[model samples]
Target: MRIGILGAGRMADALGTQWARAGHELMVSGRAPEKAAALAERIGPAARVGTFREAATFGDAVLLAIRDDGVQDVLAAAGAADGTLQGRVLVDCTNPVVPEKLTLKTAGGPSMAERVAAATRAHVVKAFNLCHEDVWRMTPPVFDGVKLAVPLCGDDPDALALVRTLVTGLGCEPIDGGALERAALLEATAAFMIGLWFSGANAQAVIPPLKYAFGAH
Candidate 1:
């Protein structure tokens, strides 16, 4: 698969390296041309650097790994290529959570993914927003002998499947998170988890086991 990543940051580097090792062609782009080139060099020969517009136009699927506030700018740069992102499967990995309080910046309006979907004709899927980028760097981020389950919210089945393949390539499982409208819930989950994590709380302990929660245990 040809994968284009919109940022040269940690999220882009971690995921791009994994996908590149899995034999996928990678195109990395960022606001800084040197950084993008450096990332591509580190990812090896199969990976290359390009402008935001070139990256956006170069792949079968595109990962928008830019910061929450930078998504619109990247999209604008990409859309300038052909005037639209129609027929593209866009993966959104941004979180609108504030740094200190870990509260959602988009508490009253559209979630980050929804805003991206609304801004373009691309089929947007929300995913990978609930964990730190370093978590993605793990060879297989399993804990307690369970592969991490990544929730994906999208309306397009094809786009979902494509992203699921990418998720599995990182040795993670992709769990259906229902329709696109549910993306806000995932963003909220990120904010909640981040708050708990930063507060030195065991966020996982807050959730009962599935069987117990279902009253079947």
Candidate 2:
């Protein structure tokens, strides 16, 4: 699979490295050319660095690994070349939480994924916003006897399938999180989890077992 990543940060490094190791072709792009090149080199020989437009145009799927605030700018750059991102599956791995209070930055209007979808012609999928980058570094990302579950929300079936494949490639289970309109729930989940983590609270304990939380099945 050909994957284009739109950032040079930790999220980009972590996910890009894993995908590259899985034998996928990778192209990394960032605001800084040198930083993008550096990230591609760090991901090994299967990856290359290119301009945002080129990266967006080169992939079967594009992963937006940039900060929440910069997503629009990056997508704008990527789409500048004759609407390069049109009809592409754009996987958004961003959380719109403000660090200071762990509250959602876009608390009212639209979810980050919704905004992304509206900004471009790409099919936007919200995913990988639930955990830290280090968590993605764990081989298989399993705990106890269960594989970690990755929930994604998107409107496109094909785009969802593509993201599901990527999630499985990380050795995690892919959970259908409903339509793209529901992406705000995932963003809120991130905020809640992050707040718990920062407050030294065991967020996992807050959720009852499936039999209890969702009734006997």
Candidate 3:
């Protein structure tokens, strides 16, 4: 599979490098040519550098790994609003939250993932947003003998399948998180968990085990 990454930041580097190592062809692009080139070089021979538009056009699946505020501009530059991304699988790993406040930037409106879907008319999937980029950098991201579970929210089955494969490539499990409409929940969860993490709390411990979720029988 061919993957295109639309940012040269840590998220882009971590996910792109993992996918490249998994034998997927990758195109790394960014607003800065040097950054993109450097990232591509770091990813080794399985990856190459390209312009945003070129990268958008090059992949079967495109990862929109840019900052939330820059998403619109970058998508526009990639001709997404002009149909460059139509019918493609677009992965959204962005969290539209104000870190200090732990509040969503799109509080009363659509999720960042929804906005990306609207802007590009692509099969958008909300994923890889809950954890820090460093977590993604882990070779398999397992803990306590369990593979990390990645929740995915998307409307299209085929697109979700592709993303599930990508998730598995990193040795993680893919969790079906309902449809695109549920993405707002995931984004809000990110804000909530991030706040917990910032406060030195174990966010994962707050959730009950599956057997006790609805009370022990």
TM agreement with the true structure for every prediction: 0.96, 0.96, 0.98
- Tell me the whole-model lDDT of each prediction, alpha carbons only: 0.90, 0.91, 0.95
- Model 2 local distance difference test score: 0.91
User: Per-residue lDDT of 59-130 in model 1, one digit per residue for the tens?
Assistant: 789999988888778888887335556769999999988887888889988888888888877899999888
Give the total clashing residue pairs for model 2.
0
RMSD of 1: 1.3
lDDT of 3 by residue, 1-217 (tens): 9998899999999999999989999999999999999999999999999999999989789999988999999999999978999999999999998977999999899899999999999999999999999999999999999899999999999999999999999999999999998999999999999999999999989989788999889
Rank the candidate models, highest lDDT first.
3, 2, 1
Q: For model 2, where is the 10-residue window of minimal lDDT? A: 75-84
What TM-score does candidate 3 reach? 0.98
Off by over 4 Å in 2: 214-217
The C-alpha stretches of model 1 lying farther than 4 A from their native spots are 80-82
Give the range of the ten consecutive residues with the poorest summed lDDT in model 3.
51-60
lDDT per residue, candidate 2, 1-217, as tens digits? Answer: 9999889999999999998888899999999999999999999999999999988878789999999988878887887436788789999989998999888999997999998888777898999999999999888899888899999999999999999999999999999999999999999999999999988998888988777988676
